[model samples]
Target: MKGDVIFGKKGKLSPMFIGPFEILEKIGTLAYRVALPPMLAGVRNVFHISMMRKYTSNLSNVLNYEPLQLTPNMSYEERPTEILGRQEKKLRNKVIQIVKVKWLNHLEEEATWKTDKDMRTRYSALFDKY
Candidate 1:
């Protein structure tokens, strides 16, 4: 089941270990571990990707070269770096604001609450509930 009809099998095998995207993603991970040098690792990764491309030709849900689509809001062919850069710029500010807001909330909560409940609980009603 490793290669394909390119080898000894005349017909397709039933429940063949071909793929679901999880296996293809796993191939990416395995490709990373292949005994290649860093530069060759990139090339080998592309090769394994092309191998995936051949089999996934018919499925609509199967993206050609993509492992996991990071954005559902944006399409892959849209050159997402520009979108990412803008989003990241916005996110940086938002995160800073969130941190400040959280700091203020923590201060407010500390002022409001004299004491917080402890986690440990004694179960006197265990058999009573049973």
Candidate 2:
């Protein structure tokens, strides 16, 4: 289907599917030619059918899709938005501090636990309020 929406990988974020891009044409029996945006000029327009998933539109499943600014290498920087919680893990010899990190464009539930030292070094602002 030419006008049907399909899932395309964008970056290292949860709900990794980036677009419901227009399907230009079928490449062969198992491939498709997608119409990617100008920002994704460096990306190949063709994709195998296995790599794509049909996007079923739903009113309750709204996604806030923002266009990502990719560098020449097709990579983008992901930033931390907030520190959700903190905990200390006790080892045999010592205790290590870890923080729950909420990243930009990700939901709170998707936040990950990272070492406090690492989070402080990369996202010091998250600790400013505490």
Candidate 3:
């Protein structure tokens, strides 16, 4: 479940599905026991039907959906690619700068707005012109 992509934090850029795993057995009427890879050992094999999707017969789909190469800790890095836009939020006594950041390997729509100060501290090259 943790390895499979979801719609929120990572946005639409995340993969929709991760497998065509073998269904070991049916669980009552709503769930199935799937044989997941060793990488997903920590997760429960039983999943709700809503979480599964019918696979379209496309060789490309299998080739394109590269399973995430995860660390032993089961986490991956998300690095920012570039700054797309910027804005300032004016408070009572200070101005807060924010920038829309495009992430590496992700589309423009997946970009998120973050505080400029934090971005600058982490990725100073993104603000070279300013």
Report the C-alpha displacement of residue 66, candidate 1, in angstroms: 32
- Give me the overall lDDT of model 2: 0.83
What range of 10 consecutive residues in model 3 has the weakest lDDT sum? 3-12
Model 1, range 1-130, lDDT digits (tens) per residue? 4444422344556333333333323444424222434333333322254354234455567544425445685534311111001111145345221111112212333322111111012222321322
Candidate 2 residue pairs in clash (backbone atoms < 3 Å): none
Q: Per model, how many backbone clashes are there?
A: 0, 0, 0
Instruction: Give the poorly placed runs of model 3, Cα more than 4 Å off.
Output: 1-20, 24-33, 39-74
Model 3 TM: 0.52
Deviation in Å, model 3, residue 41 alpha carbon = 3.2
Q: Write the per-residue lDDT of candidate 2 for residues 1-130, one digit (tens) a residue.
A: 3443333433344354668899999977999999998977877899999989989998988767878888999988888988888899999999999988888877889999999999888778778988
**Stretch of 10 with least lDDT, candidate 2:** 1-10
Sort order, lDDT high to low: 3, 2, 1
